[model samples]
Target: MEQDVSAFLGRLAREVRPRSNQWAGLLMQRMRGELPELWEDEDLARVALSETVDHVTAFLDGLEHNRDVTRAELPPAALELARRFAEGGVPISTLLRAYRLGHVTLLELLQEEAARLTDDRQLTNDAILRLIATAFAYVDHGSEQVVTAYQEVRGRRMQRRLFLANEASRRIGTTLDTARTARELAEVGVDHFADLVTVDLLESLLRDGGPQPPTDAPLLRRIAQRSALDGSPDSPVGTGRSHTYPAESAPAEALATGRPTLLRVTTPDAPAPSTPDAPAPPAPPGPPDFGIHSVLLLPLHARGATLGLAQFARDRTASPFDDEDLLLAQEIAARAAVYIDNARRYTHEHTTALTLQRSLLPQGPVDQFAVETASRYLPSGSRAGVGGDWYDVISLSGARVALVVGDVVGRGLHAAATMGRLRTAVRAFADLDLMPDELLTHLDDVVIRLQKEEAREGAEISATCLYAVYDPATRLCSLASAGHVPPTVATPSAGSRAVDLPDLPIGPPLGLGGLPFETAQWELPEGSLLALHTDGLIQDRARDVGASLTLLSDTLAHASRSAMTPDEACERLLTRLLPERRVDDVALLVARTRALDPSHVATLHLPSDPAAVSGARRFTTETLTAWGLDELSFATELMVSELVTNAIRYGKPPVHLRLIFESTLTCEVFDTNSTAPHLRRARTFDEGGRGLLLVAQLAERWGTRHGREGKVIWAEQALAQPHLP
Candidate 1:
């Protein structure tokens, strides 16, 4: 039976040779009509079906009579069809189903040809059995080959995706800009993953504190969008465009459910019937040629919250987005979301710290009676953030001014708080009329105490300060440094010089130990400039401190020193020396020296006898008359009598009295006693206590200033503008 069947198959091959082309065409027609996926891809489907039919017909034509099995080897074309399916992101199940359906068509044709040739049941049955055996053998071989090709191509595609994942992980999130991070997410998709990309962030996240919209209609603002198409990048709804999603919108659903979505975008010119279940169409995405076919909306979820959604789109020229592409888009969005959240948190903190620093600083133009001054304070860049640089102009007794510039050890709120504590202490100490060196000595104690407290909490503290006292009476500037840079002093006679100050005997920085601090006194003349600043004004990591100081001196020397007010000098110095963005905090205070003219002063040396009180009062009354201050003489005489009597009767010897005529009438009595006077209520029975009490009431301000040898009891009465003759 096998021999007869083989002979019959060989006869059948010869007889069917004329009509083999017709049989293959018929099979192709059948598959196209039945399989819709194959028909949609007309080019690949026609080529693949044509090749399969040609091979099947050739196998029958080449059948042998003596062979036990008919040979029908799988064609290389079958492997190519598998590759094409994989490239189009089509499933392999359809490829196998098509081959099975084609096998049935081939078998049906074999039976019909056999019946037309012989009309004998036995011969037809044997031909059918041999044909079925050979067909199954071919189908099995081709199916195996196609699967191998499919998997090989699929593997390469997955490898490429892996490379892209690594590329996105390495490139995105390199900066702290939240918008840049979103733009980078869009950038990653263009030309590589999709033809067009857009990133939509939660509007609530970008807006300052506010209540959110409903869950189904949460707002999303498109932060970034890019396109490979020539005109698509100019799309209006990108990079800061906002849109409110309807209840069934894709973005809303994806965010509300915390899941990624793959969807079909409606065509540009398509008409829509009103369907309540339909998602509202998003705003027009600009140019009509953008041709969006498929969209993948992936939620950017991190830290238990959905930050935003990333949308990737492909035009009609490319295949629709698939599950694998959606997965990749989600992965990329996930990476960028983490970086944006971090940037958002940092921005919140930085803004809060900046606000706190500004509030803690001094405000308004500060005018001490003895000096007119101006100052500038600049904060560092975002990288360095906020630091503790502060300056103050403090008014002291005897027409002295305390110029303070200090820098705390760190940045942010903690450093600013430390600066506040030190500034408060400096002002309190200045009121006591301590010398420059003594004020810093007391400030060092406060710093050490603060450091101890900070250290117990596992934090270290250190600081540098320049404290200077300028006495208009003597035209002297007393300066002390706690590891601070020397201030710049400019004069018409001397030119500009960075004062070479000696370091305090104390350890460097304020918090180290109790050490003796050295005070340097410069006999600054009228029109002299004393520039006190934090080290940030003169020091940076890239430049040498000496070089910076020399540059500062030269800049000041070359500037028009005589014409410059403290404000002009400060503005010019900063414009010439500092860049737009500073790396460290800067605090600069400039004071132009104004000495008390000799003509405005009247001095008298008195014998310490009890009779010197009347002479002191007479001297004050005559001096006030000569300076055209007669209107102030009554109050002035009363203050002089009380102060000089106290200085001679109970105070030390070598008493001298002086009256100064400037903005106010100043009367001072000097003695060798260092004890500060106390104001007290005079009892009904008390006699002499009322003298000091009466002085306090007659003078606008009264205070005691102690020198090394003695103390001066001074009173200032507001002057009436003189009637010039």
Candidate 2:
């Protein structure tokens, strides 16, 4: 029976071998009818046909030799076809079904051939049974090999998708800038998955504290877009420009429903409906022909709110998106949406904080006779948000001006509020004509109290401050620091250098009590440039403080070479010393020193006796008339007499009087008395208590500043314009 079966199989192979092409064609036609997805790609279809022919030829050869079907090797073409199916996104089940259908068709054809070759009923039955057993074994072996190949390719594709998704997640949202984040998302999509990608946020969402757009037809601003094609033409609506999607467009539908929509372009004219039977939505507005074939429109939904829309597109050269691609795109969009939303929130907060900071800061240029001043303030970058850096120019008494620059420890709204409080406190302290060290000491107390108040909310506060007072009358600048960078001074003879304070030690930063701040005085010549800045100007992650300070000094020296105004010097320093990426806020205050002209000043010594009061009054009256300020004689004499009489009566001896002519007429009484006089309301019967009170009332502004050996009681009366004779 075995010999008979072998003989029948040999005859069957002889008849079937020449018709292998015909049989392969038949099998392909069957596959095309039942498993149409496998034929979507023309290249894959050709591969399938060639693989079918090879399989039929191999089967016939094995039958002719009567080989063991179980030991037969799978045709390379068959394995290649299976891999193509996987790569082409055709399902594995479809490939297996094709194999089963081929096996059944081949078996039926072999049986008919066996019967035609054998006339004996017993021989035909035996041959049919042998063919059935051997064909089944051969088909089983081939199916296993093809399935293995399919799985290997599928596994690699999955890994690639997974790696692309992870790379997108790692690279996106590295910065808190909305535009940057959007660009990152676009680049990731174009590099890994899509031929083109675009990110469009609602116009209102980008505005600070703006209301959400209406859902019917939302207006979107294209923040970022990218394409795989080099030198791609600009989109119809460029980045930063706004456009509205058609009401029934895929993007609008996706946003309205908060669901992703996958569209396949069946023709060049328009995008096909998401579902085959459903009506097509309106085409999205864009350039006439981008050759886009597949589009995935994902709403940027996060935290239960839809913020914007992200679109991923594949051109004609790329394969159409499948269910698996949809899944991956959703994941990428989901991750990107979270970061975009975070960036949006950060943008709002940063704008608000910066606005608050700028409003609280000084608005215009400071006009002072002691110095020509200009200032600049910059908030931190998006990642760090706005910080608590501040600068101010406070006009003090005695032709003096106070320059202040300070930095709170942290960032955001709380730090900005803290900065406002400290600045106000500094101005208030400055009004009293307190020394630089004394003003900082008072500011330190305010910060300590603020910390105590904020401690209940689990927030700790600390800050660094630099305070300097420039007196035009003495050409002396007294400066103090509270853990802050020292100011730099550029003199006519000497180059720029940081003010070195050997005797005055730097005190602890504010919020730490019990540290005494000491003052250091430098005699700045006329036309000297003084620069005061927050540490952000000279400190960064890439360089040390020493190097940054050197750069600052060099820049200042370069500016000092020319007759650069304070404003020009400020611009030069910022251009030279500021880093590309700033993590902290920067505050720069520049001032050019001016000495009070000797001809504008009048000075005299007074004897410590009652007779000297009349002489002092006469000297002031004569000086006011000489300076063309005769109208101020009466008020000036009254103020000078009261201040000098108090100094000689209740204060120490060696009284002196000086008159300064400037924006205002200043009368100062310097006595070797450390006791500061207080302004008091006189009683109805009081005679001597009204001296200081009268001085305060008559002068535009008055204050007393105590020095090491004496105190200065000064009053400024506004200079009235002289009438034309």
Candidate 3:
């Protein structure tokens, strides 16, 4: 071996001499940019390239004397580079082959330069063989130690990846909230497995009641991001804060195809391609100045559907990810995907329950005569407990109205369904003209029965309710509660005050219905504001109920001082009282009191006699005429005469006729009797039974409203649109 090497060295001692730039240029020209890890760091590549040229020039220069480089004579910079390549875990074969390309180029430069310098074919050929031999000797001597270091580095990295995978498995899928789950994924990946991590979800899946995105391509929104690069955007779009990934890009393709991928790095100068399915995403605040070079995008999937994707990115300074790293990343993504899918299912159910509740709620006032009303309902910020509160307005017999507000004890679809049932029962009881206290007792009974009928074995049905009945003429309000929050009354004289009935004990909440519910009477004067609400509007886990109610009262008082409409009052109250993030549903109703003007109302008392019927007719006609509702007086007078005559014949004493002129003309006759007059169609031959029938036909609507004093038989006529001069 020594003699053959000496002979080869003797041939090169005469002719092989390479210039620095000549060989370096040749080496670079021969390379096709295929180096993965080394090419990533341009500074390192430049340093390595320059050192290689120097080492070759110096070694060839040394070979003229001794023809070989021992361990002592080896270039320090080249030896240091070999150690770096090993520590960096570069494939020994690729590195050796890259160096061989440089060797081939340097040898070619030596042959060409030598021949150009002197045209001796024998010497040039001899120098070419000698330089070729020198190339083989250099590679053999240099890489002998690097290959061992590289294998050691590769083995250590494998162990580190296994440790990382175990660490990630224990950390991910611990939470069922989708955003939190995504955040966990990003947090675990950053600084450990990758330099930057991002988790993006399909846009449609984030919305309530949103439909499924198209299978071809779906838009994504970044939910969580973490970055190791300084001031670099965690996402591919927007500011360094967070944003969506570009369409037709790595992350989007991963999600759209439900596939994992290692994305190709995009150059800043390349025009981004656009497709119909994947429209290009917006450019970010910074230029495409991201440090990310290697990206691993793994789709987050469970139940055969893609929830989103987890992206792990490494900067140019980091090593390129291999197949094993990609596998570990995919495992982490799979674990987090389970929790995300669970959260999505919970969201879908919560939305459906809320939708069902909203669909069941009464939109606006059904009873326009009693009050000018407005209402607001707000769901929890988390949207988990949406269906527990409700409000309603029901029109009663004498243009009186019933206002209702209630809340079920628990939440979800069952609570919403129960709220609907209780609301329906309130309306039914309101139609019967039941007193507020009586109505609550019946509602309590209904709820008890509902629980028994539904047989919710483990779950019990219970709720709180506020029922109020208002009489416009009397300007009286009778309110009753089933362990509910007392209402606040904001009158012109008194800014706002809770109608706290000191002596009135609130009955047990519905479902525990043995005790009788008591009614508290307070005259809510004309133009007064009544605010009724559920506990959610006033109370939260962090606040005291009394303190919340006090705040609510002050809020309403402030709103009332502004002379706001009922709707405006509700909005103002909500703005002030509702917390930034509410944990429960809120139901609120604000009604302004309305009363009939004395001038619009006329009344006459009468003894038990047939002649009083004519007097009742005269009173109705004159009252309608004076109010400019004379067109309706003919029908009103006829209905009144029939009602009064019926009361006289049925033998009730101290009867009275009352007339009210408003949007509609109404005539009411009060009798000492408790019997309610029923309307029936009389047979064609029966003239005797047609008086009540004639009253029903003449009046647009008629009904009896029972009062503590007596039963009121009232008839109504829709007034003419225009009044004649």
Candidate 4:
């Protein structure tokens, strides 16, 4: 029958795949191939059946769910179980009768088989008994180790859980949705479960990483307990009497009881228990196995919230775990609390930052300027995108206005504060009636002082500023830059051109001194638009400022020239010009010159429009008022008349009149004259030659330039003040 069953088993194995040597060997050995002929006799069949049962149990032990045992090592005893099953299985009574013989009891036989399948180190019976009873079986038996393996694992797990919970609580929009308290509890449970056993109790409990723990008190505690031990209620490391327990029991007991318990046990081999918290009394006289002793329990709670409790004990009649242990547990609880609170605080701060950022950005359009204005501000992405970028439109003295935009160095509150200061300074300077260049110079001084003060306080900051004044009446914009990108102009007639108002960055970035500065001026045409921006708009990975500028220029050229409103234009340009992420902050201002349409001609025709003569005097005063020069307009007319009279009489001219209107009035009379006009000293009595001298004295500036047509004599005069007579 045994041979028939063995053949059947081999045939079954072949159905799966032809049996390999390992399987073949197991089958051959099961057929009593390795046993003596004497033991294989008919009467020994009962013993064989009994041994077959034992082998079946061992085979089951060797079949681990995970990587616990190797198939190469299935015992010869296990093959016999397979053969017995293949034949007629043995009865329970038959196995018991065999066990009653000198062979090991079922428990001992199973333990031996377990040891073999698990590949555990071989040990004597006494050692095996001690191992099943105490956790020391898992720990190295060093002479000086204080806490048992169980105690150490518990402490470390508790600490780890608290930490993980705290982190989850702090983040905004966290992966865990539960309340901080509950989440923290859950975190503790999950970490501990993962740390202790093959069974993933903690992960299973948090399947889907559940939102913070439920407020249901008992349920939360159960969850915590389930995580602490494989859902067992027994103590993990210590218990009453010298009887031993499994290594996964200490936290399980604390979790199940919903209360903390201290455990103390005196094994037969160690010293006696002493006063609580004291070292265990000296070793008792006996073999070395009897010295185990005291234990202590402490619960963790904080801010009226209870976490879980813990239990700890010594192994060799050492001092009982005491207040020190409790105190440490309490410390761990406090640390856990702090971790949770910090996590929440971080979440709150992040949310607040986003809201403030949205609120602080400019909301609507600024009124009064004629240009189709647009602007873009980009903050650094790494930090909360908040920085000191600003733009403002302020109404000045006349129908005119001041447009300002600038960025401060750095980010956050400091940059914001600097931006505010510089903006206010620009308005104040503009109010003082200083021209753009002079206003920028004054601001440079202010920046320098600010930097010095900041440095003394161990804080460093630097900034750049650009100031512009727009006169609506004259349709001109005067600009001054302080180490800023020169504003670009896109004219209806001239595609796109950047103004050449280059200067060494103003006042050494508002800190360092001895910086030289110059101002550049350009004639703004009707319907011409200008864009002023910070370096952030152009910054890229090329590591070169020029490269960044080229990229910016190219982007601007390709940008859609849609007929959108000023705000929309700004939004579109910004959306298209900037990269998705920027390394620095950007602030930009766009303004266009309002269009101008002139009616009728005001002309002063002269007969014998001579190269050197004078009909210009009568023409000057009368023609200017006709052009609405008024008190504001008188200065340009008088200077123009004088220069024209001088050129016609002394020098040469076809004798023509050219009027250029801007914030200041400019008048020139072109003559076929080759001599450059010079400002020279005239004696007080010199009348005729003194005409040009008086023109110089009365006008803001007077000069002569050889133009494409001829030598043109020009003079500039400030417009009359508003309400001026």
Candidate 5:
């Protein structure tokens, strides 16, 4: 009975072996009908046929030799097919079911072959039972091996996906720049996740933290794109190029619905659908073909808003995407979305703050007679946002110019606002012609008041200021600091040196009131360069303040020796002193000292008597005539007469009269009297106050300045042409 069954089984195997190719073809056709996903692609179909043929050949040989099929190695084709299935994300259950269907077909073929060999029912039944047992053992062993191969590849694939996700999370959004963050995501995708990756964001989101309005067609700007394959055209749109997506496109659909869309291309000629989770649509027909087989379009949605879209794609050389790939892509997109949103918000805030700070700063040339000035203001890098550093050239009375550089001790809108306020206050005090030390004292008080106001909001306000006044008449620069760096002065003859305030006290920063500020006076020569800068210019993390100061001094000395213009000197200093990535705001003000021409000024000592009034008026007329400012003679003489009379009447000892010719014709009277005359509306019968009132009415501008010796009552008349004769 064993011989008869074995002979029958051997006969069936010999008959099946020659027809194995035909049997494998029939088996693949049946499996394709039941398991469509496994045979979706031509490559997969080929792998399936090869695996089927190998299984058929091995089974027939085992039956013919009565070999122990259960202990045999799985066919190489079977193991390869299993790996392909795993990579393509086909389920193990589907593969197992296809094997079961193949087994059934094999049994039917075995019965037909057995019937062809013999007619005895018992012999046929016995041989069929033995053949069925052998087939079962073969299928069981092949299924176990195939499953092991699939599981090993699947496990490694999942681990790689996890690693990609972790890498994306760690590297994205390292800087608060929208474009950079997008590029980071693209790099991670190309390195580990996809062959081609692109990040596209709505124009509105990048411009102003606003959502794009809904439309039939969606537009997205491609901010970044990366491709793993060299010389491969990954995207039709280049970086920073904007293109509109059709309403039915996967990217548009994903953006509109704020969901992820997975697309698989089964055939080159098949009409792919644009719907989510459907087959991929053919890309626009043109040159530079993408040859893409799979794509995942995911909307970058975060914090209850959709910001943009991220696309991951694979070419024909790679496996088509599946459910597992879509899930992994979604995970990475979710993390990237948060980072992109953060960067977008930061960009908006930084832009707004910087704009406000720039607007509040002084614009255009200061055009002061005391000094020719140039300035530069630079905000900190993106990570720190905008900071509150300010510089100004304030035109003061008596041909004096006030150079100011200050820093608010924080960043963003609040600090900028504080800087604006402090700058306004300084200008106001400057107009009053207060001394540098006294002006800073008042500024300190203002800062204290600001701190008090903001304290209730749980915000503290602190600031530093350096105020310096340059007087052309005296060629003296009086400077005072409130916890700010000293200014550097470079001369034509002497090298650059930081102003020494050894005996003078550099008071505490503003907001700390009750400290008296001291002023230091330096007589800078004409053509000297004075540099007033915030601590940002001379304080860096990599270098000590002393070293930075020395560098600044050296650069300034070189600039001065080179005879560069104030503007050129400013550019040179900034280029040399500034770091590539600025961590703090920088404000630099460079001024070239200019002295009033001695030929334009006339000074005469006078006796404290009524006779001096006429002499002063005569001197004013002569000086105006000599300077070719005859047009202002009448007004200048009358104003000079009134000021000289007031000084003689209210004075004690010697008086002085001076006339200056420059932008305007000025007449000044100096006396021992310390009291300053005030402008008042004179009554009809009051002859006493009319003298000062007449002076004010005749002169374009009139004021009184007090000095250690006494007081100076001065008045200026407008000149048609301010040039010297």
Candidate 6:
């Protein structure tokens, strides 16, 4: 049976073929008779049907080729089968099976025919050609059967390729943002012989150069290249045949007319000859000979500027690109132009902001004042915005110094103006050496005056300011605050503390109507440092300002061990305090305790006793000797002796005396006397009346203070130390 079937298949190869419709009828009849009992798998049955049809079509194609060659004879049934197979939709898989079985030579003959069909020339000797290698797969190339199959498989592959190409283009666009050179951009269009040049005029060249840029002539600039026939060049780019791109060929004309242009150029140089014996030099590089006819140039535009253009050569193997592709390129160029401009503007603004901000800050140290200062102002990372916070270190007479930092209410120029006004006033007052409360009250008046001129709400200009006067000689800090953070004292032995303020805000902010601002004072001990700042240090609306202060205190506490000087400690704390997204400005000032030799100042903490008085007087005398104030020590000893004796006799316990043995001896006695102790007239006969009179006579200056806990009686005597020249 197999031999008979094979002979029949051989005869069928030499017959005429029918169309697919009649072949379908014959296959259905054959399926019913040969495979009725095996009809369980509907899916498998469909597969068999498709396979059978493929083989039948291959057999019919073979039969036609045989008729042309051998004029072979065919029996009636074989002839009918060949005709039916052609009309049927046969599967290639089944035809391949039949070829392997040696039933026919159809596969070989059809393959030969397909090979001859390779060259598709719609026109012969056509002088002009325009082809697109990519377009051929889409519209014109391949047979009906092959084209259909390609639509199913190759079409999907093309879709995926196009998607990836679009994504890559987007990424390339991102990479080209702000790119200024043609070479840099050419790396993006790696496969093309492309140059990005600036277009200044419709008929002229531009001095500046770039791939995508702004141009005044939005309609006339163009980009162009040589055709496949002409070939690009044998230069570093391997695209062989070389052609000249005349300045005239620039699509400036087409763009000026609101149209696009496509042209082709032929190169003067021919492919170099190769030797028969030697390995041929690489075929002079050139565009692949796919029968390209012309080059296409498209104009780019954005923001009413011509910008530049894109040029590409058509493929010789395919139809030339048409209006659709040109439109796509134009769209791509438009998007690219906008991106370049935005990037440039952003860079310019960023640089400008930094410059303006630095200009508004204070730069140098003031003389006579030992000041340690630092400031940190961070702008929001967002585009086009800034804030205002500033600081000052001012110098004054008598070895006095002032620290000032304040934050204006809002942002931008208004806030900056407010900051400048407030700082200037503080510096002027600092020169006056006004006490803290007096200075703040004066500042309030200035703010009120400025508010009247600006016509803005005084409430809107609200700010916090802390002023401290540091006297290096006395190691005393007379401080006052106006709605600002209080100064903190960090002692070598006592750690850190916020110095207590006994009064309400040194009167309600300067512009607000309020009376009587009181100044606060503290005996800033030797080895004690003070920290002052604005509300920006501790206040945030999201978290309580108090909590921020706690955090600050903790940071300052930890910083004490590692930092070497007041400046170093302030820097450490500032770095931690200004984290990202800081909503306000920060100013910090640190003043270390003025160094004093132990011999110059004698400290006396004595009980209110006649013996204690005597002890303090002896300490004064001995301290004077050490400080070389011996001559003055005699006067100091007598004055201190009398004060201690009076406090022991009728004054209170817990007397304190500090003998500052500088150019003079200052005898300060702190006693529990509520009464303001006085120096009365002493007649020649009254020895007790003469005690204080003797004190007044011996010292340069003497005073008494009625403090909260007790009264302090103090006197100063000239020192014996040699004067500085």
Candidate 5 per-residue lDDT, tens place, 138-192, comes to 8899899999999999999889888888888888878887899899989988875
- TM-score of decoy 5: 0.82
Candidate 2 lDDT, tens digit per residue, 518-552? 99987888988889999889877888999888888
Q: Please provide, for model 6 over 1-725, each residue's C-alpha lDDT reduced to its tens digit, 9 standing for 90 to 100.
A: 43433333333333324433345334544554544533233543454445445545544543333222122222233322322222222333432232232222223332333334334333211100111121122112212333344245534544644653474355534532244322222333323322211211222223233223322323222222223234434222122211222223344344444345655434523222222233325324445553333444555455665544445444442333334434544454455546544544444444454445556666655433334444444454444344456667675433346776665566555666677778878877765546677778888888777777777544366666777766555666666666666766666555554434344344455566465666676656555656666665665556786777777766665554344577676776677665555555556666665544555555678875577766887787777677666767677788888888877777787777776543335677777876665778867786577788888888766766444577767775544453421
**Which is the leading candidate under lDDT?**
2
Q: Against the true structure, what is each candidate's TM-score?
A: 0.80, 0.81, 0.67, 0.42, 0.82, 0.43
Candidate 5 lDDT score relative to the true structure: 0.81
Question: Which segments of candidate 3 are over 4 A away from where they belong?
Answer: 1-192, 195-294, 315-317, 335-374, 412-414, 449-460, 492-502, 540-543, 551-576, 609-611, 649-654, 672-681, 687-692, 708-710, 722-725
Backbone clashes for every candidate come to: 0, 0, 0, 31, 0, 28
Residue 440 in candidate 4 has what lDDT?
73
Off by over 4 Å in 4: 1-363, 376-378, 451-456, 496-507, 513-516, 541-548, 560-564, 596-725
Q: Quantify all predictions' global Cα lDDT against the true fold.
A: 0.76, 0.83, 0.73, 0.48, 0.81, 0.50
lDDT of 5 at 189: 84
Error of 4 at 302 (Å): 13
| Best model per TM-score | 5
Candidate 1 lDDT at 94 equals 80
Question: Would you give me the overall lDDT of model 3?
Answer: 0.73
Provide C-alpha RMSD values for all models, in order: 5.6, 5.4, 9.6, 20.9, 5.3, 19.4
| lDDT (C-alpha) at residue 270 in model 5 | 28
Winner on TM-score (5 vs 6): 5
Tell me the deviation in Å of residue 188 in model 3: 5.6
Residue 262 shift from truth in candidate 6, angstroms: 10
lDDT of 2: 0.83
